[model samples]
Target: MSKTHEVVIVGAGFSGMAAAIKLKEAGIDDFVILERKDEVGGVWRDNTYPGVAVDVPSFTYSYAFEPNPSWSRTFAPGNELLDYAKHCSDKYDLRRHLRFHSDVRTARFDESEHLWVLELASGDRVSGRYLISAHGPLVTPQKPSIPGLDDFQGHVIYTMEWDHEHSLDGKRVAVIGTGASGLQVIPAIAPEVGTLTVFQRTPIWVLPKVNPPINRFASGLLAHVPGAAAAARLSTSAATEALLLSFIYNKQVPFAVKSIEQLCRAHLRSQVPDPEVRRKLTPTYGFGCKRPSFSNSYFPTFLRDNVELVTDGIERITPTGIRTVDGVEREIDTLVLATGFKVLDVPYDLHGVDGETLLELWARDRKQSYQGVTVHGFPNLFLSPGAFGLAGPSLFATFDLCHGHALRVIKESRRRGATRVEVSQVAQEHWMEKMRARVGHTIFNNPSCAGSNSYYVDEHGDSAVLRPTSTVNAWLAQHRFPFNAYRFEEPSAPAVSARRRATRAAR
Candidate 1:
C-alpha cells in the first residue's frame, strides 16, 4: 500500500505515544505510530521480568495529560507500567494511529520530496514529512562472551528476553551482573530458587526504595485540585535533577553523593550480618558514580540463607556450572544474565546523511546533538532522548519534554515556511563538549568507577546519554525549537537537496 503521513513515529513507547497524543491534540491526525511489536509500550511491553519496576515514583512517571491516580504502588512494576502505557494510548485515541508490528527496516531521507521513505518489514513503503525516532536506546540487548555458554545444559535466560514458559521453582539459579536488572531479578527469583548465586562484576550502591502507596486522599485531592499532581511532578523532577547535579556539577556539594552512598552502605551492613558479605557487596567507587539502584527489598533478599554474593570475575562457563576467576566452580540449574542494554550505543544499522551510519558518525565524537533533539546532517529528523537522553528524575518528564520540544520545533519550522532544518555543527559540537565536560566532573566517570564495565558511559568515558538538567530547563530551552541555532532552508532549496539525497539513497 502506498500511503503517507505528515508525521511518522518509530517505536510506540512513552515518546511515540506522547508524540501521537500531542500531534492529535494540535489537530494533526495525519500521522502514524509505527511499532515492531504487536502492542504498544515499547520497552515496558517487552521486559516483563519479575521485580521489574520503574525507578521513579508512579505519580510523575506518566504523561502530564493522563495520570494514574490508582497506581497500586509508588514504583509500578513492569506489567503495570506497560498497562499504563496501553491505557494512555487507548485513552488518548493513540491506538488508532499505531501501526503495530510494522518494523521500519530502513529510513531513507529523500531530498527531492523533502520527506522520509520508510521501508518496513512487511514490504510496504511509507513516506512522512517529519520523522520522529522515539525508538529508545535500551531495546538493544548485550550478551557477554562467556566460553561454553552455548553448551549450557540447563535453561539460560537473559533478563531483557525473559522466557515466560521457563520456571525457576526449586532450581539452582546463578544470576550474573548486579546492575539495575540484577537487583530486580534477584529479589524476584531468590525465594523461588533452591540456591541463588549472584555474580557481581562490580559492587553497586543500592539505595532503599522509599516507595509507598499513593494515598487515596492524595489521589482524590489530585483529581479535584489538579495542581497537586503537577506540583508533585515539579517537585520530584527538581529533586532528581538536583541529585544528578550534586554528583557531577558539585562533587563537593555537601551531603550530595555521600548521603545516598552512606544510606546504601548502612542498608547493606544492616541487612547482611556477615562482614565478608558486606565487604563483597559494598562498592569501592563513589555511590553516584554508577547508575545508582533503588530497592529496599534487594538487600534483604540477598541476606536470605539461599542467596550467595560472588564477587570474583568469571573465568569461563561450563555446561553445568560457572568457573570464577578464583577457580571456584558454582553449579546451578539455570543461568540468569542481568547484563544491561546498550545504553550508549544506538544498535540499529541506521545511516543518515550520505550513508554515514549513526554509530560510525558518532564513533570518535561520542554523540553530539544540539539539545538532544536535532543532529547535524539529519534534517527534519528528531530523536527522543537522543544525545542528552538523561534528563529529569522521571522518564515521563523527559518524554513530555522531548515530545513538547519536537512539536514546538515542528511548528516553528512550519511557521517559517521551511522544508528542512538541521542543528548547526558549531552548536552541536559545543553542546556535545559541554555534556562530556559535565560527565568528566561527575562521579560516574571518576577514576574509581572507570575500571568498572558499565553501559552508563561511552567509549570516551562520557555520560552523553543523560541530560544533567530538569525537565523545565530542557523544555524552557528547547520549547521553541531554537531556529537561531539551526540553519533552515527555504522550501525550494530543500526540494533540490531532497532530490540529491534521494539519488544518494538509491545508491
Candidate 2:
C-alpha cells in the first residue's frame, strides 16, 4: 500500500516550489512535490529560445520574501530565471520533498478514503489527504495545425522546445506567429539568419523595452540598503497595477488605452522609415485585447535587408517552404513556430467527486472556481491560477496570492481536524457570477477584440483569463473570505473510535 502523505503537489515549477515553501512555513512537512520532468524549473527549463528574457521588470518578478539583489538586467535573461528557481529550491531545501520524473497521469479523489489518489505514468500510485495542482497555464506548447506542416523537409523548431544544437547561421529561416515569443525570437535571430521571413496572422501591440544592466553600484545598493529592494518592487508593482487597470477598465479609463496606443504608434513610426511596413506592423484591434510585448529591436529587425514580413495568409507549408494565399511560395531552410501555449484549458485529467473530470466539467459548462483556488466537487484540491484566478500581470505576484489562499484554507482544515474540505457550490457560483459581471466591462468583450484572436477569450466567448479585479482587492479577499463558504468534513465516528482504541492500547 502506498503511504498517504498529508499533501500532494503536482509540478516542481516555481509555483510548486512556492507551495512547498508555504506548507513548510505553516509547519506542515508531510507533503511531496511530483515533477514530470527531471529538473525543477518548469517553463523556464523548457523554453530556451534565442533572445528569451522576461518582459516584466526583474525587481517585481521575484518573490517578495526572497528578493534577489544580483539581477544582471532589469529584464533578466531566461537562464537567470532558471537559476533563480534553482536558488529558491536549494535555499528552501525543497529537494528532499521532490520526486522528479514522476508524471501524474490522473488524479482521482477517493471519497470513501477521503484522499486524492494520483496515478503516475510509471504505474505508481501516490495518495494524499490534500492535492494542490501547480501545473501552470503555459505547460503545453501549441503547435499550429497548418496543413502540410509535417511534410516540411527542412529543420523545424518550436519556440518552447528550442533546439540549440541546430545552427541557424546563414540559413533561410521562416517564423510563424508574431506573438510574444515571436517578438523576442525575431530580433535575436534576424541578424544571424541569411534571410528571414515572418508570417503574421495578427499584429501585436509592441512597447519600447527599457531593459538596462544593473550596474555594480545599483546592485550593491539593492543588496546593502535597508529598503532599496522593497521600494523598487513597490514602484514596479504600482506601474504594473496601473497597466493592468488600463486593460481591465479600458471603458472607464479610455485615456490610458489611448495614451498606450499613441505611444506604440509613435514608437513604430520612429523605428520603421517605410510607412507601408509600419502600416503592416500596426494592430487594428484595441491595445489591451491581446497580450502585448516590449521590444527595442523587433521593429528595427524588419528594416534589415535580409528580413521580410509576410502579411498574406499561409495556405500551406510545402516540402521546401511555406505557400501563401497570394500564390507566393518562399523557400526556407528552417521553420520556427513561435506560436504560444495552451492556456486556461486543463492539460491533464483530474477526476473529482462522482468520477467527473475537471476538463469535462469545465467543457460542459465553463471554467470557474471559488477565489480561483477551490472548486465545488473537488475536495481538498487547490489549483494555482485556476479559471479567472489570475489577479495581476506579474506571475510571481499571482503565485503569492493564489498559494497564499490555498495555504490559509489548508491551515484552517488542519485547525478543525477536517479530513475533507470542499467549497460550497453556492459559494463557487456566487464567485463566478461576480467574475462574469466584472469581465463584462473589460476590453476583452469589446467589438474591436473580435478579430484579435486573443486567448483571454475562451471557446464559450467569455473572458475567463483574468480575475477582473484589482490586485489589491484580490489580495484582501484572499485573507478576508468567510470560512463558511467551504464545507469541512471530519472522519466518521467509527474511524475516530478505532483510532482512540489504538491509542489506548499503545499507551
Candidate 3:
C-alpha cells in the first residue's frame, strides 16, 4: 500500500504555499507539498537576469496575510522577492511539509481505491485523496523554432534559465523577442556589452515605471505603524485596477484607451528623442491587445549608439549570427532568447477517472474551465487558476481567489461526509457559456487583438490567458458561487469511520 496524504499539492510556489498555509490554519495538517526544484520561489528563483524586478508594485504584489516591511524599492528585485518567499515558508513552518526534489511524473486516478496514484521521478509511489495543481503557467520555457539554432557557436541562454557563469562584458550580444523580459534585460546589459542587437517580432507598449526607493523611514513606518503597509497596498492595487479597466472593459471607449496611449507615447517621446526610432518602437496594436511592460530605461537603451533594433523576421540563425528576412545578417558573440514561456501549454500529463487524459479533454473542450479552478470530468482534483485565461493584473489576487474557491469545495466535501467531489457537467457548461459571453465582449476578441500574436489567445482564436472579468468580480464570484454545482459522495463504511477519526483529530 502506498502512503496516502489527505491532500497532495504539486509545486511549492506562492499558490502551493498559500494553499498549505490555509489548510494548516483550518486545522488540517495531513497534506504534503511536492516541489520538483530544490528550493521555493518559483519564477523569482528561476529568472535571475540582469534587471529582474516585478512590474507590479511591491506592496500589492505581496500577500495581505504576510506583509514585508523591508522592500528596498516599490518594484522589488528578484532576489528580494525570493527572500520574501523563504521568509514566508519559515514563518509559517511550511518547510516541514515540503518534499524537495520530488518531481511527479504521473498522477492517475485509481477508481477502486478512490485515490490518485502518483509516480515520482525516483519511482516512488504515493496516493492522495485530493490533488491540487499549483504549478503555474510560466514553468515551461518556450524556445523559438528557428532553423540552425543549434549551429550557433556562441553561448546561448534563455532568460528563464539564465546562464550566470558566462559573463557578457564587452561581448557582442543579440537578444530575441522584445517582450517583458527583453525590455528589462536590454537596459541592464547595454552598458556592459560591446554591442547589443534586439530582434523585434512585435513591438510592445511600455509605461513609465514608478520605481522609487523605499527608504529607512518608510520601512520603519510600515513595520511599526499599523495600517501603513495596508494603505500602501490598497493604493497600489487601485492603480493596477485602474489600468486593467481599459484593457478588459473600456476598449471600445477611445477616450478611456487614448488616455493610457498618450501616457505611453509621452514616455517614449521623453526617452528616445529620435522620431524614426520612436516610430519603430511604437506598437500598432490597441493599448490592451497585448501584455504591456513598464520600464524607465528600455526606451533610453535603444538611443545608445552601441544598440541596434532589428524589425525584420528571422529567417534562420547562422554559426556566427542571425539572418533576417531582408537578407541582412548581424554578427553576434552571444545569443540570449528572451522569448516568453509556454503559458497555455500543460507541462505534464494528468489522468482522471476512467483513464481519461486531461490534455485530450482540454484540447477537445477548447481548454475551458469553471472560474479557472474546477473541471467537469475530473473529480477530487483542483487546478489553481485553471489553464484558461484566469490571470489578472494582480497575480496574488487571482491565485487567492482560486485557492479560496478550491478550499471551500474541499471543506464542504468533508462537512457533507463525502470523500469525492466533482463539478457537474451542467454547471461546467453553464460557466463556459458565461465565460464565452463575457470574453466575446472584451478587447481580447476585438479585431485589433486578432493579429497581435499574444500568448493569451488559443489556436481557436479565443482568449485563453485572462479571465474576461475584473479581479474584484472574480473574488466575489468565487466567494458566492453555489457549492451544490458539484456532486459529493460518501466513502465506504470503514473509510467513513477512519475519516471521522481524522476529522475529529483535526478539530
Candidate 4:
C-alpha cells in the first residue's frame, strides 16, 4: 500500500513553516514539509551577503503566534533573521515533520481520487490529499544576457549565489544593478574591496533606515512588566496599520511618506558632493514606484575613496574589464551581478489543468489568482501572496498571516468533503481584470518611467509586475482566502486500480 499524507508542503521557507504551524494548531498533524535545502531558512539561508539587514522594523516583522520578546535590534541583520526562523521551527517542533534535502519536481492531482502525486528530484513519488507550493517568487536569480559575458577570465558571481569562500579583499569588483540586493551589498563590501565599480541602469529611491538597538531597560520592562512588550508590539502594529490605511483609502498621504523622501534627498546631497553625480543617482519616478530601499550606509559608501559609481551603460564584458557604451574599460578581477530576480516572470512553460500551462494562461497581460490562492483549471493548489499582493514591511509576518488564512481554506475543504478545490473561470478572470484595473490607476504605470529598474513589467516590458502602489493594502487584502471567490469540486471516485485512474484523466 502507498503511504499517504494529509498534506505536502513544498519549500520550507517562511510560508511553509507558518503553514505547518497553523496546520498543527488546527489539529492537522498529518502533513509533511518538503524542503529543497538541507537546513531551513528560505531566502535568509540563500542570501548571506555583507551588510545584509532587513529594511522592515523587527517588532512588526515577526509571527503573531511567536513574538520575540528579546529582539537585538530594530532593523534585524540576516543572521538575526535566520536565527529567528530557526527558533520558530524549533519552538513549533516543525523540524521533525520536515523532509529536508528533498525537492518537488512536479505535482499532478488525480482528480478522481482527489490526491496529489508529487514527483521528487530523487525519482521518487509521494501522494497527498492536499498540496501547497510555498516556493515563492523572489529567490530565483535572473542573469541578463550580456554580450561576451561567459568568456571573461574573472570570477563572475550573482549576488544571490555569493561565494563565501572566495576572498573579496584587495580584489577589483564590478557590482552590477542597483536594486535592494545591490543597495545592501554596495555599502558592505565597498570599504573592503581594492577597487569597487558600481554599474547602475536606473537609480532607486533610497530612504534612511532608522534602526536602533533594544536597550536592557526596554528588555526588562518587556520581560518583567505586564503589557510592556505587548504595548510595544501594539504600537508597531498601529503604525504599520496607519501606513496601510493611507495607501488603500487616501492613496496620497504626503506627510509621513514625503518626509521620508525629503530625508533621503538630504542624505544623498550630503554624501555625493558632485552635483552631476547626485543628479544621475536621483530618481524621477515617484517614491513608491520601485521597491523603496532603506539604508543608512549606501550613500556613504559611494563617498569612499575605493568605491567608484559609474553611470555609463555596460556594453559588454571584455577580457579584462567591462566595456561601457562610452568605450571606457573599467578593469575588475571579480564581477557581482546584482541584476535582481525574475519577479514578474516564473520558470519555463508551467502548464496547469487541461494542459493549459501557467506561463501560457497568464502570459498575455496579467498574473491573476482567485483571491491570491487558486487559479481556474489549476485545481488542488495554492500559493502565498498569489493573486493579491502581500502588504506590510516583513515578508515573514505577511507569509504567516497568509499561511493562517490558507489553513482555514484547507480545513474548510476537508470539512466539506471536497475532493479537489478549484476556482471558477469567471472568478479568476474577474479578479485578474479588477486587479489590472486597479494597477492601471497607480503611478506604477507612470508614463515617464517604465524600462529603468522595474520588475513590475510583464514580458512586454510594461511596469505590470506590481500595482506600483501600496505594499500595506496588498498585504491586508490577501489576509483571508475568499472562499466565495472559488469553486470546490468533490473527488470523482476512489480508483481501485492505477490504470483506471490514468484512463479517466487522459480522456
Return the clash pairs for model 3, or none. 389-464, 389-465, 389-466, 389-467
- lDDT by residue for model 2 (1-507), tens: 367899999998988998999999989999999999998989899989999998888888888899999899989999999999999999999999999999999999987668899999999999999999999889887889999999999999999989999999999999998999999999999989999999999999999888889999999999999999999899888887888999888778878988999999999999999999999999999998999988989999999999999999999999999999999999999999999987865567899897889988988988889998889999999998899888875988788888999988888988999999999999999999999988877889678787998888888888888889899899999989999999999988887787589779979
Better of 1 and 2 by TM-score: 2
True-structure lDDT of candidate 1: 0.78
RMSD of 2: 2.0
Q: State the TM-score for model 2.
A: 0.97
Maximum-lDDT candidate: 2
| Regions of candidate 1 where Cα sits further than 4 Å from its true position | 215-218, 252-254, 470-472, 491-507
lDDT of 1 at 50: 82
Q: Pick the candidate with the highest TM-score.
A: 2
Candidate 4 residue pairs that clash:
351-357, 372-387, 390-475, 391-475, 419-491, 456-464, 456-465, 457-462, 457-464, 457-465
TM-score of each: 0.92, 0.97, 0.95, 0.90
Ranking by lDDT: 2, 3, 1, 4
Give the candidate order by descending TM-score. 2, 3, 1, 4
Per-residue lDDT of candidate 1, residues 1-507 (tens digit)? 457788999989887888888888877889988899899988898888888888877776787677667777767788888888878888888877888888888887777667888888888987888898888878887788888888888898988889979889999999998888888889898989899999888877887777778778867877778577778767766666777677665445646777777778888887878888778888877666668778878877767989888887899999899999889998889999988888745544556767786778778666777787778878888888788765776666777777777787777777888777777888788877777766666666566665566666777756677776545666677665456787776668656777689779979
